[model samples]
Target: MHPLRSATAAPSRRALACALSLALFPFVAAATDGMSDARTLDRVVVIGTPTQPLTFVTDTKLPRQPVPASDGADYLKTIPGFTALRNGGTNGDPVLRGMFGSRLNLLSNDGSMPGACPARMDNPLSYVAPETYDTLVVVKGPQTVLWGPGASAGTVRFQRETPRFDAPGLRVQGSLLGGSFVRNDQLLDATAGNATGYARLTANRSESGDYRDGHGDRVPTAWKKWNTDLALGWTPDADTLVEVSAGIGDGQARYAGRGMDGAQFKRESLGLRFEKAFHGALRKVQASLYRNDADHVMDNYTLRDPNPMGPMPMPMASNVDRTTDGGRIAAEWGWGDVVLTTGIDAQRSRHRTRNAMGRDAYKTVAWSPDATLRNTGVFAEGTWTLDAGRRWVAGLRSDRARATDQRATRSAMGMGGMAMPNPTLGLTRSETLPAGFVRFEHDIAGSGFGWYAGVGHTARMPDYWELISPNMGPMGTVNAFAGVRPEKTTQLDIGGQYRGKRMDAWVSAYAGRIDDFILFRYPTGGMMGATSMASNVDARIHGAEAGVDLRLAADWSVGGSLAWAWGANTTAGTPLPQMTPLEGRLTAGWDNGHWSAGALLRVVARQDRVAVGQGNVVGRDLGPSAGFATLALNAGYRLSERLQLAAGMDNLFDRAYAEHLNLAGSADFGYPAMPVRINEPGRNLWLKLNFTL
Candidate 1:
């Protein structure tokens, strides 16, 4: 049997049903052995701190109360101004402040992992197992130009911290999870090291069956996944280090909103890094190189029988793959109150695909290259402290981006199976993009308040999906690439944070004007089912997010947050499509020495202002969505200094609700003939056990 399949396959029901009983046996055994010890037990906290204005950082290894996340997107949704484009129970695409796609620069340990599917069946986050990483960092908006280019929305990084050992030692941490719908998960991280070197391993597996919605209707959201990674590091001294890492993973999922399911999601990755600290003006230097590959398979028969009367009448499958290689090197200098950082980075990626009519036939066919993309960038950022309470920060960057079209013929969707001439065949488009930002920050003396304001400008070259996937082009061109222009955005952001003895609060606001915004238009009912046209237009966007946390007592606390976003298509004279609705979250928690409890109430307002058939590459507005609210409850207990247990119930009321930015459930999933929002999961229960040694 294949290793990937064996790793992800479901264990016998008898074994799964006995998981809890088996887990308690170990707990009881450990408790009896530790009864004579007098060590103080550490309290387990279920809820993490609320996000501040411009940045959010948290320990990914911590156990979250409302059931641990299955993927990066599920975890990111817990932060402010972040939402997921739900398709099913897992692998949803994440949107930040109404922005989607490449606008959000997502990275794993500073490496890029681009998905293979043109429709984004395997988004970058889908491959990320958040709990396997040590830290998750988010930089909101284009307030900084350090990570990469064209990050108009934000940047998200999943990072693993290096371990430093003074003497020979071994460390281990792991978790086990069980829940409704036959959900099961396991994670393990282990490290062995001496003062000179170390070796680390991380592995995880997750699986679930189809879950019933609020009305007892089964949703086709079943999935199975597994991943394993290893790293070796050498430390010659305390201030210098070198490391190498490799990883492989695979998964399969059933989608409730699409015609086809993800039959396979295969991944491979490799990376090398070096860091050194100097005593001179060049205080520190760092360099890293990485490569990632994604091989995805989508089919109509692998997970479910083909619907003879539906759009796809027979067994069919498409295999798409992408390989990306990138690296970055940077040096930092500091003198007194001034600091500067400079770096140069480069990336190259190629995409290819093959399709066949019979099951697994695509594997026998030769893969045809569709597109190749390349980018090289240089950037510099500086910070100067004007006084003890004031500081100024600024940055500038330039990138050379190029894309080559390798297709011999265009997709024959609206053309009735007749291959049409490829307008961009054997052609390459190149663009130079420039981005910069400036900001000023002030700390109110003895007031526990800090304020910051910044302005930024970014010019972004069109991405592969926006340039090549549309069925039709703008009014005058033969294809999207010939007519779609670079996108330019200028924005101003301001925010303030206050920390008091009993309360902490933060609020941020932004306004931006965009020139040559790439917009997609879908004509209703085409011979191809749905055909999209890509065009450019002028636009405006503005939004704000605020959050506050208050400590009612030493053991009790309450927190709430609000996020609202608005945008307009100035040229089209209509509201922008797929905008996130006004949303708020209220949470209260009580934590004692060894136990914790929490409740969360989430409320979202109706979004009526929408462009019906217009949106970004992932999804479009499914008419106006109604507002809804859901509640969740969680609790935790510390069994011992090295063991802890947590449990939670999501959707406490089991109310039926759907998100505004959603894909209509496909008829293959028993949805109505006409498109409609896919309902979210109903009440669910889960329990998790964490152990460290």
Candidate 2:
């Protein structure tokens, strides 16, 4: 039988999934004696390619090429159709098929943790430590209504598996890493549990000094961060579970792409979740409530000496914070050949800011509230098994989205230190958005082929970054808040997957049309330098990601994947700004039960189709970026039943290149102020050790 399976086929029972995943973990077989299977090598090293259609899943603890330095964006970039807008060595912003920001729904443990940076220096992924989570799931396109709304681009979830035990026992896992540029990291996960209850703790710390680029130039990108989380669960019976979790984290990072660096990034979180199963047609019920907060401080003096000849010639700091509270309740029901899930979810976020001219002076000032955002939605998804191998899935959703502008005054966005009275002060805007999708999937009888086609639509409300960040609106409008309209996206997606004894392949492609699509224009520099204006325009987007894995021999395999995206502003007759260039990756692997090795070659094509003076809130395009290729190699060894070691050398050729989606190197770093892209890292080496008990 073939192994082709869709992500929607995930286990319906939590206990069964946990037990199966723990027992069948492939690494266990490869680390123990009496194991001689040639294919066992698949479980020994990095997983760069995927076999599932429309979804990608991987174990977070596994070693990977380029060895991410505790950053979730770095890890996600390894997947097809995904790339990071590089800032320095870490905390890059993730983009999927040219879509970023609120278009991609990012969640950690079923909760939302939005960042507070007005310029998005500290994106959502900046605070997520990949190794602390158990599984990473990416669902491309707005094809599912189970998660919250506004996911026109896709949905990404970092999950911590539910822990279950038949008897009282203690389990522990840990890893340590040391790499070039004084990079170091430590992580630990421990659990003590019995049949009726359990306690789990996860903690991690990561740090790195400034790194040199391919030109041997030192980039201001040093950072240090840490996180700690504790979870307690009660399972009165095999079919019931109640869990409570809390976490806190903080960090700081210097920047090479912007005038100011991230002086502080503090995070706080709390959550409660409940799950239960029944014997009747009502199969399962799950509920959760969570609150997350992000507090950030940006300053020019903390990381580097402020430029005496440029803007902000003195030490200046800005402190911003956002608090997000959300909850969800879902239930699953099964009747013969049909299964359905219904849920209601809501979220509220409040933002505040304070600033001062001297170091640590902002702490003495009272915070000023500027915005409040809220969303509430209800959804229903159902799947019908028409036959043994054919299925139909459909979903419907409606949301009430509200945004309040609490600004007391408006600053002349292009005039240095200029202030003006607010025009939309304390005004509230509300809209009811509807979203839905449908799909038909079939598994070829007695074959390795499976295919699915789906169509989806989502009407997205203007987020804080889009609604409030820009200083101006379209030509005649008063401001961004009153001019920018909601974005409506309709997209069609199709994919197929095939799994055989020696080959695995998958292909996914999508096309979308966006109405009233929000676009930002960077006009000529004014008194305060270049400023952006928010406007609405029609747009077209399309992309495709395909992969194939071939096992030449029992112990040898080769794989390759390619991703390409394209977009155009139909209203302006220009290419879309910030579109990702074509990218491809090739990998070759060889391993025995006791040892494993692999090589990765990444190639990025030049992006020549760019709307030079337009983009999103992150930044605008800087002409065309040239293409480049880099190679990375990794090796691993099973030291014993409870221990293992892995190492990697990235950018082996030390070729200098910058991504298309990049911020210009800041003048504070001794670069010309002509908006040149920041170069990536040079040759790097790292080693890691993992242990389990």
Candidate 3:
């Protein structure tokens, strides 16, 4: 009963195809390059190197190794210090520095979009289609407070650039990709307008069938996804701006590790923002508001046959949804060599669900409200330029957070398959969390080298999945919500970077102590199978990620990155569960005029440490894992100023392997009931055509 695995599609597929064709006709016919400057074809990115200390910025439109992912979590695997628990082809939850769940603040256009699945089948990153955005920004560790709270791990933002036109015109950029497993994708981003105002639209569709592992065994990893976004903006002056935006999307993903497949994933969003700049001390003011809705449905019958002997023998479906709303306002002030930024932000989210025992039966059940979460925070940051090559930066923030439980009964964790009265029903929990950080950066005079060090502390309230997903609480407690406490983390961060004529290099390291760290334990043999229990413990974690890129010639380059993390539970004197093993990537790329090619080699060391039944809500450690190595090759050719072609071969040797942070394959999918990690895709091939007009 690995939770059931597969997906289903609805009507209007012909309509979807027709709309895409019509929208793409004009762009394809106009094939004139509109770039401001001449460009050469860039090789596929094997691993994205950080651009600054503790921060990474990359163009999301670029091609990547291991073929492009249909979801955000898969795309993020291209960055160091990042990995995802493998579920299937899409919607895998991302983990940074061995941290999962809300420890990482995920945002799109500065607004949070949390999913409704208690087991996180639809994590925040699941809704993000990386290519739809213009830029991807990552701030590692709790080094800044500009975003919202509970970013003890870090913050991730996917942002789209504002469209501008000095004169009336039309611009478009799009791509077509095809790969193994019947994989196909189409993307279109277009804009039209003049200086007074502009209209922009971004859309994409992707689908794939089940893929085979290295051993030629099929893994239930099929999926279909699509999205459409529109934005209208007004840029009246050089320093003034206003915008309105809206988006809608839906998707279905099959997971080999879960008992239920995602039959439906629907989303809707709206937002508004304003920005203004002044000439003097009052530098700028910015404000924005956004609302997002996440609706999801998971069922066993849609994609697979329920095994009569399995834990879930009957057809069943569950529908869940969450609505989130938030707003933020900030102002920048400049005085001499010093600058300051201050802002206040607030957010509210509500979760509801329904379920039934037959096909699409959940549609007839009344929705039940389960939880409400709210948070308000204010922050201030200041930067002082002591000299041309030296500077100091600091920030402080405080958030008032609250959570209310609305359930009347709770499922017993194998206690005779009975429902128990909710002891914490209608109870409200509140906490005031404080966070701050300060760091010093020096450029070493005229040298192209810089270094920084910072200390940060933040208190985080237990998130929904941690408090609500777990079936049990600490001993002697009624449930997770009534017993679990907020976690407090104090960490030290250090990093340095060098940018020379022929080479660029960077390295970052961190160590942290967590008070009342949240931990989930999976106990087997329950009436409903595996059950999750939540508790708190004292823990310590440390990790480092480093990389260097060197140019062998004007058109040839070589680079590599390494990341490793280690943690320990002080309370139990055991190694941390679900920790990522030591991993490294090596790449060689060449770009000559109109043609480009590259090769990437990735390696992972075996992970022997274990606390087998303990991990986050999605899964627990499944014993020790053998390490593996994989390779990929890519080539690209610029056909003209307006179009380019790129192709790749991943897992060149067809090596079979599984990640340490992955969920156990479901018994319904033929996996042994003793928890076997799902294997990754085998050798695969793909081709992509990119165009701009």
Candidate 4:
């Protein structure tokens, strides 16, 4: 009973081509009428540039090659040392240097949007649309403490810059995309403003049908998503601003790796912010508050029929939701060459769920609260310029985290056919976590090279998923929260960046040790079907990433990057699970002011070191994954001052490949009984048009 066997027919090639033409007709017409005026236009091209070590910043409005991403995780894969654990075409969990979950602090406009699903059916990045933001910033390693807690791996921020206007004006930007597998996308951003006030709006929609692999086998990856945001700002005077914003989004996705599919991904968000400048030692003040809610529904009968002989055996559904509220206030002071920033922040979140035996019956069941989490932190960061060629940066923070468990009884399925007592019933636990980092940077005399080294330490409390999702606890413990200790990480990071007239390069490396690193143990063929246990162990990790770009001629350039990561469980003497393999990317491009063309050649080394059935919250390693290489081509044309067109072909050779950190296809999808890695999309062609005024 394969799902796709009863799925609807795919779009015909002729129909797809017609749709693409119709979508591009407006841009083509504008190009014909304004080609002579194109000199005033800004070039819109698709290849992303290499990032520097430690910190990288870029404009999110720029289009990316291999087709623009539908979500944040998909877009982050362009950066070195980053990968995603894919379940389908969208909502893949982001991983950095073999770390997942709270280790990588992700923020959208300085707000947190943690998902509610214990199994992570909707990760934080699931609600983020990268292109909707104005800027994207990445800080590697535990280099700073101003943002939030954890972040042992790194920090990612998607921000929208405030708009300023001297007089009444209107600005608009939008794009349309058409691609293989009946993929279609639309985005719009509009703003109207004067010196005293402004109104802004952003909206986007994306949809795609199931795609076949190179072997012509269909993968259950269809999805549809939409988002809309509105904001109002008041500028009382220069250096003063107050703004309020609201947003809503929803989507549905089919997964090939799980028994259930996400039928609803509803989201709502609200935020308020204020900024003001001052004289004397106090340079400025900033504060903000936000609330985000995620409501999700999963069922086996929504998108496909339940396997008659499978574990489920019948239609069923589950609904889960989480609401988070938090705020932060900070003050920035400047004294000569030294700047100091201090802030306090706090957040509270609650989770609830309902389940029913019949399809869509969950709606009739009353919701039951399962967990509540709270955290409050205070921090200060400072930067000092010792001289023209040297600088020092440091920060420290402490957080109090608390979790309350509300389960009345434990599942009896895995307790030897006997009811098990709930050891954590109405129990609450709290921990105090401290974190800090210090770094020094120096510039090479007479050269464009700068080098930096830093040391950081972080103590992290176990998150909801890690504390309550497992079926069993470690040896001698009744449950995870009752025994799991806080995780501590200490690491050293070193990197250098070089900026030259014709070439630019950067490299970053880190080595660290972890205390009480959370680990999951799964028993094979257990009575409850592979029950899991959560425990802690010591571990060591190291990784490095490097990239370079060279200008061969006035209109030609070439670039490439390489990344490698490794980890070991010192207590058990085994290689860590789900580590990304050696990866390299080579890109060549030519730009002639108005037109550009590029090619990307990606090579991944085989990943033979794996600990099967052991990994982070998102997914586990299936087995060893073979190496693969893929070639992609892209071309762009700047037609006029208000229009541009871009086209690309991914996996030009139609090579069948799967990422090492990937979800295993499900038996319900016609996959083998044994877990096997799901293949990536095959040859794909896409065209995009951009318009601005």
Best model number under lDDT: 3
Count of backbone clashes for each model? 0, 0, 7, 0
Model 3: residues with Cα > 4 Å off, grouped in runs = 1-41, 414-416, 524-529
lDDT of 2 by residue, 480-507 (tens): 8898999999999998888898998888
- Candidate 3 lDDT over 59-123, as tens digits, reads 88888888887888888888899999877778889999998888999999999999999889999
Candidate with better lDDT, 3 vs 4 = 3
- For model 3, name the residue pairs that clash: 2-259, 3-258, 3-259, 3-260, 4-259, 4-260, 414-527
Comparing 1 and 2 by TM-score, which wins? 1
Q: How close to the true structure is residue 400 of candidate 3, measured as C-alpha lDDT? A: 98
Candidate 4 wrongly placed segments (more than 4 Å) = 1-10, 13-23, 26-53, 412-419, 524-530
Per-residue lDDT of model 4, residues 1-693, tens digit only? 333323226466633763667466664567345433222433333333435438777677676765688888887887788889888788899998888888889999999999888778899999998878987788888888989889999999999999888899887778778888878888999999999989999999988778878787788988889999999999978889999999999988898877788888899999999999998899999999999999999888878788887777789888999999999999999999999999999999999988888867889999989899999999999989999978999999999999999877665343222446788989999999999999998865468888999999999989988887776667888888788888899999998888898998888899999999988765432221246677899999998998888999999989888989999999989888888999999999888878988899999999988887787666776778899999999887777667667778899999888889887777777877777788889998888877776
Q: After superposition, how far is residue 164 of candidate 2 from its true place, in Å?
A: 0.4
lDDT of 1 at 265: 90
Model 2: worst 10 consecutive residues (lDDT sum)? 1-10
Itemize residue pairs with steric clashes in candidate 2. Answer: none
Off by over 4 Å in 2: 1-51, 414-416, 524-529
The residue-level lDDT of candidate 2 at 135 comes to 87
Tens digits of lDDT, candidate 1, 1-693: 423234224535623663565368346636433533233433233333435447788877666745688999888887778999888878999998888888889999999997998788799999999989988999888877888889888889999999889999887777888887777888999999999999999999988777778887878888899999999999989999899999999999988888888989999999999999999889999999999999999998888778887877888899999999999999999998999999999999999999988889898999999999999999999999999989999999999999998988886453224578897898999999999999998875578898999998988888888887787778988898778999998989999988898998888899999899888887533211267788999999999988888999999989888999999999989998878999998989888867888888889999999998788777887688999998989887776766777778888999888899888888876787666887888888877777776
- TM-score for candidate 2: 0.93
TM-score for each candidate, following the candidate numbering = 0.95, 0.93, 0.95, 0.95
Residue 406, candidate 4: alpha-carbon lDDT: 84
For model 2, how big is the CA root-mean-square deviation? 8.5
